[model samples]
Target chain A: MAFTKGAGPHQRGLTIGVDIGGTKVAAGVVTPAGRVLARVRTETPHKSKSPKVVEDTIAGVVEELRRDYTVGAVGVGAAGFVDDQRATVLFAPHLAWRNEPLRDALKARLDLPVVVENDANAAAWAEMCAGAGRNADDVIVVNLGTGIGGAVVIGGVLRRGRHGLGGEFGHMTIVPDGHRCECGNRGCWEQYASGNALTREARELTQAESPVARGLAQAVGGDPALITGPLVTELAQKGDRACAELLEDAGTWLGIGLANLAAAFDPELFIIGGGVSEAGDLLLEPARKAFRRTLTGRGYRPEAEIVAAALGNEAGLIGAADLARDALPRWRQGRRQRRLSRSRESRRAF
Target chain B: MAFTKGAGPHQRGLTIGVDIGGTKVAAGVVTPAGRVLARVRTETPHKSKSPKVVEDTIAGVVEELRRDYTVGAVGVGAAGFVDDQRATVLFAPHLAWRNEPLRDALKARLDLPVVVENDANAAAWAEMCAGAGRNADDVIVVNLGTGIGGAVVIGGVLRRGRHGLGGEFGHMTIVPDGHRCECGNRGCWEQYASGNALTREARELTQAESPVARGLAQAVGGDPALITGPLVTELAQKGDRACAELLEDAGTWLGIGLANLAAAFDPELFIIGGGVSEAGDLLLEPARKAFRRTLTGRGYRPEAEIVAAALGNEAGLIGAADLARDALPRWRQGRRQRRLSRSRESRRAF
Candidate 1:
């Protein structure tokens, strides 16, 4: 009802989408059809960061992107809880935001309507509309990078539950007291299934007093600290049995986590993104097998299809842009039209 | 849009929703606004050697309900895998159905259209339309009884994914190598948090080796087998320290599972339904604490409001009736109107 129906496609200026991550901040201008028109990026500072500085950094990126396109509004996809109004970052584990008034602050600086969303939600939206999940209606997008991140899209809309913490798939305890997670919990899903976990396991396995350590030892030299997730991927891809086993271990744990996700949210497709996903089937083949085996009532259930993301690193950029486009006044008009249709269906049911 | 939206409230023609459980088969008629009409229940046949008899028995219940109302379509919510078309029971552990064409078989006997869905999805739908979630536009309904079940609805529509095998929340693993689950998986969410686990722990605690179990041992007459989920509920309510601890333990596990769900679906509301919910805060208070404690980046996110289901056992009836109300020929009037509006939205969005 608040939307204007049939507002033409280019009725207003474009908005900017800013993706704030632990390592970097990316910004982009997106079109209504979900295409990113322009983009810019800047690395995040390591120590003694101020809120004003972060805002300025993000604003600077937006200015660069905005120069090419007349920006109307802005959307920020932060790696933390976004308030219900999509205005504030209540807290961010890896960032400087602590009960920060992110939207208003950014709006004050940029003079635009800034809608903030969870980063996982933004990535999932990108995959659904223009990435790996182009045609799938129900999908769970898992980002397997430093720590595991997740977002669920059910019937074409992001599911950002009551508290905005709906996609914290990494924290689901997979062990009662397995590993000490950065979140101060034991046996959280991320502690075992994430890139950090994988790298840690690789280092441990290579240093083990067993025959499996030999090949890994030769690959990474004598330095256990030298092992990394990419080296393990290289080892596995090079057909190293030891590295393959390590990946299988990670994959098994990954599958175990995914099965839990399957049981919790039965989406049709699972889009695996992030750095670890680049290992492709080496990680996924075992994950697929383990997912099938771990799923509840295995023989009695229809399994969800697991796939890799197509958008790669661009997902965040594209996702942010798409979110920005949707915030534009013209898109609001179109959304109103969709809402009208939903209400029409509602009326008929009544 | 096969449903006829404009049917009268008291119309004789109705739809049947059948909930297939390990213990019983319950069938009822539902109204569009999520009201259950007449209901009938029959004991689930023992794990007999014959599969046809079970279906025959279910058909008998449907037939009896049909005799009372002008039942138009039939919906079966089986506790196992429903195939892609929602036509056949691909597999069921409790029931003997392997590639069973449930829809056609039932349709053949009743001469009606039949749609089969996952029991979890159906139950979730029941809550969404008639139970605790009647007002939510987006909801994640989790059933925490003997086993956990899940259903996700966005914008008031239940999401069934690619096939109907969506919303299997119990199998989502909260712990890695935590406990062996009946699903042949290690450490499924249900392994630690369900009524089964609750009662199991209660029995183990009250065994001969433990002095702390004196309170429960005195009540159950040393018969460990008598420790039912409800008995535990009663003991927990009466301030039995051992039993209270047991419920708290289950609640913590439930919280862990729910946190995972929150991370995945981000539902506006979480409706906790099922038999185990009868214990009220004895279970929920701990769950809330644990959810807050374990949620990733706690205090940095929006959280789902966990509430007990209001509709109770009659949910399936109401949800099924509401679903079928649209499937009938007469409801086609509503479909026609909705299509017009939807097309208009598509036109506008483009």
Candidate 2:
């Protein structure tokens, strides 16, 4: 609350960062160094499921944290497509944000400058600025949550493509006719490599009463529906062979997906984040092996290093705050120009 | 050779561009407007199977074109990876050049500033500057020849990633275990969607003696091994049903690969060039269809236009020349700094 460790009077002011997911709203007052000074969390209020309700929930969290610190700006990392200007949410699958003007609404309600970004992009920027990708000029972040999301950082700048919809790596087809995806595409990379893929595969194995999943089924109380990604990860961490094998299978697919990304981006490093990445080498080793095998020009070209995310779950909030803080100077420059132009109008009237 | 019509005297001097493939060497004297002032072609001297033999052939073509035009610089677009400095050929699959210092060799041999570039990159740049992607801020070029090759142009500059290898779209895996690729990967997009794929499919049909391939086999004089990509293209152009269907299938795969690229890059336009691209609408319509169907966030996001290359084969040569001409200023800057540093060294000696 008192600015993590040290806060001199001359120090730069803090900014609030909000990570809005489907189930939770995690907000924090972040320092310029990406330290979370104070934080508040709340259920997403999905029962209301309205844009106003969501904004009010986010505002409530900001209000609680701002009381403990002097804040400069607010940045929200939303699980949706943010406009090129970072002013609106084009669409979010779990939120009632269909082309919602969330930024303007929040700015008006809180009387603070606001900037919004795609959640994955915010996380990637956080890694580049403060986490594993620090000092790396070109990096790609593949966040393997229930779905796979990605962000590209080139020359240390976040690349939001032509329409602010670049990093949708999960949906890239990996097995042309392989598995059906919620995105309505068949054989999406996420369908085979993400947390959902692991849970689905495990669930199917248990449902079919496969011998390999005997221990997993027992841990899930004999209910195939009770199987979850985290349960499988926990089981794998505890040295469960079936769960480990499942992770390895998913890891192989993940590696192939990474190879495809490498073919296009040729980044120096890849940062793996999201929920499933918690499996660690249990998931990455197989991926790396497959990547080496599948990478084009395997022996000739340099391969990108694949590593886990350093900021963990806090990356989104931290990145959001920093992005807002970075945009502050430009926003102020714009305000000054408007004020100067207004004064010129007044002088002309005189 | 004279400048193209309307090129004023104050315009930049012409430069020579050479497109060196495994089988042919195409060279041109190009003006600042991306117009070819003069051109010459010769068979590649792969009989000697030496890098120097290839260089001498390139030099022979450049020397021939230079005699007719007053050139400023020379640019060679080789079918390989060009280093970040644009001064070395890191590796070429077709030519016997592995980490060859072709630029310095050419500069020494010709006494002119020389720049080497990846052929796909050169073609993409040409399209951006003068062809299909003219005035477009962001563009992706997919060249579907013997295999697929790609380049990304963001803003106005070509993007060469961390190690000067970014746009090898042909190698991106579209199907997990669909087909074996020459790069040793299975189910690469090129394996399913390139000219080789088309020719292979047609050849297979003829080899198996399918009734649909009757016309194609007859066109190839009943020799399945005689089937080439152009032969299939020509048959399709003449309204051959089986040949048309093969192109359509390959186009669909091409479209899927393009969708994967869109997910990563989000370029505003995609220019499809290369030898197989000559199939025109016969190839593009199906690709566009598959692209629309497989594209992530299909209805919500703006789709990139997939079109044909207007400059055709000359794009490589013209773009190479333009790249060399552009590098001339920077090359001169380095020389000037060297001269100034040498003077300071003499001063230190005194």
Write model 2 residue lDDT over B1-350, tens digit each, in one string: 34557653334567889998878889988876677878899997774488888888989999998776677889999888777778888888887788899999999999999989899999888887778877576789999989999897664557777777889889998876678998888888888888899989999999999999999889878999999999999999999999999999999998988898898888789999999999999999999999999998888788999999988888899889877875576543211112223323422111
True C-alpha contacts between chains kept, each model in order:
0.74, 0.69
lDDT of 1 at B74: 80
lDDT (CA) per prediction: 0.73, 0.84
Predicted structure with the largest lDDT when compared to the true one = 2
Query: Cα deviation of A7 in candidate 2 (Å)?
Result: 2.6
Instruction: Give candidate 2's whole-model lDDT.
Output: 0.84
- Measured as a fraction from 0 to 1, the native contacts recovered by model 2 come to 0.69
lDDT of 1: 0.73
Per-residue lDDT of A1-350 in model 1, one digit per residue for the tens?
01234323243444567888888888777654455666678897553688778888988998787666666678888887776667788877777778889888888888877778878778877787777887676688998888888887655656566555677778777777788998778887777778899898888876774677787788767788998888888888888888888778877788877877776566678999988888898889989998998887676566889999887776776676566655566645222213223423433221
Q: Score the docking of each candidate (DockQ).
A: 0.40, 0.37
Q: Which regions in candidate 1 have their CA more than 4 angstroms from the true location?
A: A1-17, A28-39, A68-74, A111-113, A203-227, A235-243, A329-350, B1-15, B29-37, B49-51, B66-73, B206-209, B215-221, B329-350
How well does candidate 2 match the true structure in TM-score terms? 0.92
RMSD values for the candidates in order, in angstroms, are 6.5, 8.2
